[model samples]
Target chain A: MIEVLNPTAGPATGKIMMAERTGTLDGLRLGVIWNGRPYGDRVINSVIDLLRQKYSFESVTFRKKPFIGNVAPASIRDEIVESCDAVITGIGD
Target chain B: MVDRLTADRISVENLDAAMELYFERGWTDGLPVVPPTEMKVMEFLDYAGLEPGRPLGDVPERDRVITAEHLAINAVMAGCKKEYMPVLVASVEAICHPDFRFNHMATLGSAWPMLIVNGPMGRDLGFNSGMYLLSSAGNRPSSTVARAISLLFWNCTESRPDGIQRGQFGNPGRGHYCIAENEETSWDPLHVMLGFDREQSTVTAVSTYPGPYQVYCQRTANPELMLDSMADAISTYDFYRGTYILLVPPHFAELFIQRGWSKHDVRRYLMDNCKRSVADLKRRGLWGLHSSEYDGFAGVAQAVQPGDEDRYAYVFKPHEYDRIMFDDTTLLRRSDIYVVVGGGNAGPRLCFLAPYGVSTDPMTVAVHPV
Candidate 1:
């Protein structure tokens, strides 16, 4: 018989569970965090504008990460968390 | 002693079955890996004088805490010898550094780590710093050492294609990123230049694009003309431009040395001379919809040279592009470019590893041999 160990760091620990779904978008504050890629702002803002035609939002906040190659800074995160109720962030090209 | 291994061990009927199991589990890098058996993992830890559970560091962005046990298992699977444990451990620490930006590996840019090994340890381990150092010529120490790190990228950091590693077009550097700075040079070795003792071995991990684009400049001995050729290749319009690494061959180094040009002199020349004009700089290569307006040239990823009215290229200075009426855009500073002398004395060509645009500088860490 032969034995070998698992290669990965195994499952990640201290995983933050997915936040509860807001159930609905109407009357909720909308936050959009776009990676600073070209036209990303346009792609996101256009969608928010479309959504606004269907449902009323208390307010909408737009934030751009400092750079495309970094995580959002704490100040930006605080602004989003404090001013907005839900966020929409995009990934990959 | 370190924390006992907590990883579950699976019993298989034969080696082939174990390999099959590894493949099914998505543990291998599409190649045969030595089964990381219990004894081998413990031996690797002992060679590095590390406990199994000792946390090397955390790749916080990936939400992974790399431990000595994880390093050992991956190292053994990559077919590395026990003696290579220290180098692998050191490389992990360097890559985990915030400045190194371990989190940004998975992107359309497809940036991977290039390890520049220095000190006597490179020689002791028979790392090929000569011809084909970057090729798959089976230089055991360098290949296995780099492979071990790649395994870490796969297993611990989730660099698999199906996983978080989203490279638009990946290259072979993903498998093994050529390392081992040719210590046999007229100038101080890379480690010494990076402020380390001549005796202490170290590894510097830089987030680099995969291709080591070769710059052929053997016709003239003049340093200025050589920079004209090399600097043209270095100055590019790729995703963007930041720091660059130039592998200067011995013959190429001779041309500069004969002209009384030190490494710093070569860097300063590239910085001051290579600049692009303000008109050329107006085209937003990747920033806007004007990528097509790049001087009627298609895929001219190399940064646009100085346009008419201005006479400069790329060498990046922190000046406002619109305000500079007479100056061309600069790409990087003297300190941003790292020139290392390596490769066999025979080759007339040099290699350049370009950066992935705006990124934190590559970080170097000392290899603490046990």
Candidate 2:
């Protein structure tokens, strides 16, 4: 049998494993963060529209990242957290 | 001690049965394996002078600690002889090198590790260095050793064939991509120039994407002109945007030797002279600025401003062209330029510039005598 270790440890482990729960989509403000790839924005926009039609969600906020293959800056992540109940991020070419 | 079933010596037939069992269990890479019998495994452990449970290294991404016994088991499955353990150990060390960045590399959508063996071990293991050396010529220990190591990666790591190790277009090298330096044919041995003594056996593993693009310049006799051609070849759209190069075979070294040029001299020239202008890159449809979040022609903005000459100058500074073409020259320092003498003595020097996003350090395993 193979013994597996925790991939991240110490401070990194705590941050990585912390999960936020999401409730129903109805009337919830949704945010989409796009990583400048064309398909990413399109995918996020499609999801938003579909969610809106299905759940009659209140509103949507959109943020576009400047670079591909990189994570959004902490400020942007904070902005996303403050502005929307739930956020979806995407990356691609 | 008359014949109990357990007392029987595990013969070749029993080994074959075990191989079949491994296949039935789906533990192999769809290839037949030489069953690693307990005796064979023990032999390998003893040959490597390793304790059964000695830790090879921790595979971080998998979070699994690999012991010497684990590797020995896989080596047996890969049909590796007891003597090949040294090479396997070295390869493991190279992969686990902090600079090698194993976690990111394995998960990338690239092919399996491209094993490039260097030093005296190449010759000792009967690695082909002349005439279609990289291609399969059969029964070469170097080829099998590389194949075995790759197979070990698949079996041991979380990166399996269908799961995390997702390679879209895998090359044949994935099976066994290894060769040695034709040091006897070249002016200076590859490892010696790279700070290792000529007597020291070393292996340099370069993570590469696919087979190299050939840059042949048979007609040019002048070394300067030939080098310019080589620089131009390396400056192609794909290469210019990428990082790392693997200098292969006859042509490159032969030209230098014929003209009394050193590896350092050639490197300096390539760094100084090889470049593509921003205008050229733009003209070739290589450079473009697009919305990072969007795709297609609509998202693509002109990479360079039409009238911004200063920005253009900024992008194409001296020595910067080579950097742009292949990341930074810091990457192209003496350490990164892995030279191996191979292929026929004649023809253009075959240089393979590695594609972008591939790791530059190769995984090297030493070959021990069986």
Candidate 3:
């Protein structure tokens, strides 16, 4: 009779994967993407107002996404990448 | 001094040596454990009918991979019988499912998975489905199984006391949280009512962060009125809109049975009736609405759009009490309401709400007797 050997007794073989980040947020142009909802629009407006009052900005632009839980549209994404220093997206209810 | 084993066959004399090896390898839950002798480990591997090196699953976020051999080692340490290996394996599988989000669960500052057992295996494993079931009053298999799984998680995964698993106000359930769905007394078995085959045994592992909240109601006969009370309970400040509910005891079911009300009926009633006006939620200061950089206060002020008849709908509306009240219940079908019967017979009481910080739909794991 052929004896079946269990192979699972070996030492554990796996590693933890971590998320990656690009660069720091310094004087980059900030692009804000808002879901075309009342809450998102409102939050964007508040943020813009604060930036205007507090810091000097190189350039700032705004784009609106169609749905709350969805990614920004291609047009909006392109606009953000081209125009803004760093992108800020909001999922306001 | 430890006795030497012949042909990898460890004797009882090597027990202390094995425990010391485990301690050196950082494989313990603080509590002392019985050493996994080579013979005992072989027994567990045989019981699971698995190869000693079969990969259980990876703890993705932690970067550590788990295998059957690791689980068997932890099981022996947890004082589990070799016959319980199948249940342990199944629980590990359920937790590792992508939907279960095991990585998020380990780091999140809440108690680990609360194992809920259903089906015939629950009774066969000596789990408590009746009175004082949630408490540790009875010497049932529920406690032992729950403890065994928790130990496995701790040992295999990189979860240590103050390391990664940080539960601020840990619950007693942390010690071991395994309870059965009282199928005999219940009008519906938990798994069957949750869209599983009534005959087949299934384990669901839900990752809830805040633990469960209890909702008790008595003295209301009208189904609508009773559901309304449930709505109020679910709409509290702590209650989020999308969390699930676990119904306990037969009293709630008795009400539905008496009124010819299906789970769907209760869900619809709660959804339609449990809601307060969007204005009410804001007035009560329950909205944790955050303002963005662009909007400023002006944007936030504008976000409160005018509702019908010039009313403003709050950004965060109270969750449809109906959805939170019944799982498996669809908004349209009302009958999709998920109801599991358990606990001792008493007044109509239900436990609803999911863990805080994590997503709704906690993973539920059932430990079976092999």
Candidate 4:
């Protein structure tokens, strides 16, 4: 009999934990973080601008990462979580 | 005699059917596998002295725990001899290292792992360190071991081409890339340069942009003149500014070796010469309003406030200020420059250029013999 080992990661058992939903976005502060990729900040800023047009935001703050091709540092994450109601981070280029 | 594997068994009428079954299951790199039978994988595990479920390393980014059995299966499938298991195991450990940044293996760029074997064991395993070092003709063991890693990345971490490994311009090196440092040619073996003992055998892994930019230096043997040519290639506008591996063939490296120059000297020279002008970067559209402080223009962006037509006009101290140096990425500090010797005596031709980035540096792990 021939047997082959299973190389795939075992079944993906971790559940996706979603954040609590807030019904309204009115007057909530939003944080924007860009990972230093080209044009990521512009895209995020445009997104926050669009959000401002629809709902009134108490404040909007932005943070730029020091490097690219890396995960955000814990210190940055802490700052964003402490100051903003919702944070948006992404890659544009 | 080898015992049959205890993992789940699939009864196939013949080897051909087994190959087809594996292909259909997407358990391959779109290449013909060796139809890893029970005996082949068992022998590989035994050669490495590893238990079937021993955890080799984990790619937490992909939620994958690479185990001994998983590697053995892929090694057997990639046509690796049982004796090559220890090197294969060490290679798996190197790539899974957090410093290697296992997550970047899935990036939508031409980044892929380049494996370099160093020390005595490299020759014992028949790894090619001469002409066509990265090619199949130099060494089957090197190529097969590299191919096995590629297979593991695809099967274990789910980095298939059209899947997570989104290489915009896919390369042939993505399939297999491994080389043995030409230990005899260099002042020091790569492992020793990386802090391992002279006798120790190790594998160095780097997630790099695919394919090497070959540099040809025919009759000119002057160290400075040849290095000037290499520095120009290193500063090629298309080359990313980061850790670059220069595979200097024996004859080419001999130019400096004859002059009694050390590897450190080569690195310092390259660091001094491999730089781009700030104005060149701006002209290439790389200086778009980013917040990061560039080499010459520190805080110049904040100084040049918004809504100013001549924003950069005052930024230059003089017209010569535009000629100041800069790097594309800050991760590769001046000290991060690395060099190694390899390639056959096939002329004075070799290659060098930038790999992925500095976020993921070259990782080295010793290979322990069973």
Best by TM-score: 1
Model 4, span B111-229: residue lDDT tens: 88788888878988888887776667736798899889888777777788755777788756765688888888758877898799988999988777766778875557777777777
Off by over 4 Å in 3: A1-93, B1-26, B106-111, B273-276, B283-285, B288-337, B356-370
Question: What TM-score would each prediction reach against the true structure?
Answer: 0.88, 0.70, 0.67, 0.85
Relative to the true structure, candidate 2 reaches a TM of 0.70
Tens-digit lDDT track of model 2 for B1-370:
2221121133334545656665665557788877665566677888888876686766654555566776777777676777778877777777666555465433344644555566667777777677766666674566667767766666666456564565666655665666677776556666666666666676666666666656775567776777676667766624333234545466657667788777667666666555555665555554432213212333234455565333331111234333333222123322334445666666665666454342233444443433
**Chain B TM-score, structure 3:** 0.75
Greater-lDDT candidate between 1 and 4: 1
**What is candidate 1's lDDT per residue for B1-370, written digit by digit as tens?**
3437878889999889888888889888888889888888999988888988899978876778999999999888888999988788889899887767676677676888888888877778777787776766778778888888888878887887889888878857765674677766577777888899999999888778768888887767788887877776665534234577888987778778878888888878777655665445445332212221123323334454444336443444443431222111112212367888878788667778876644456888999889
Highest lDDT: which candidate?
1
Error of 2 at B127 (Å): 2.3
Per-residue alpha-carbon lDDT of model 3 for B87-159, expressed as tens digits? 6787787877554546443333464565666776766666677776666755436665677677666655556
Quote the lDDT for B348 in model 4: 61
DockQ of 1: 0.52
Instruction: Give the per-residue lDDT of model 2 (tens digit) for A34-87.
Output: 765445666878887787778865668888754343356688889878888888
Q: Least lDDT summed over 10 consecutive residues: which range in candidate 2 chain B?
A: B1-10
TM-score of chain A considered alone, across all candidate predictions: 0.87, 0.72, 0.62, 0.80
Model 1 scores a C-alpha lDDT of: 0.74
Error of 1 at B361 (Å): 2.8
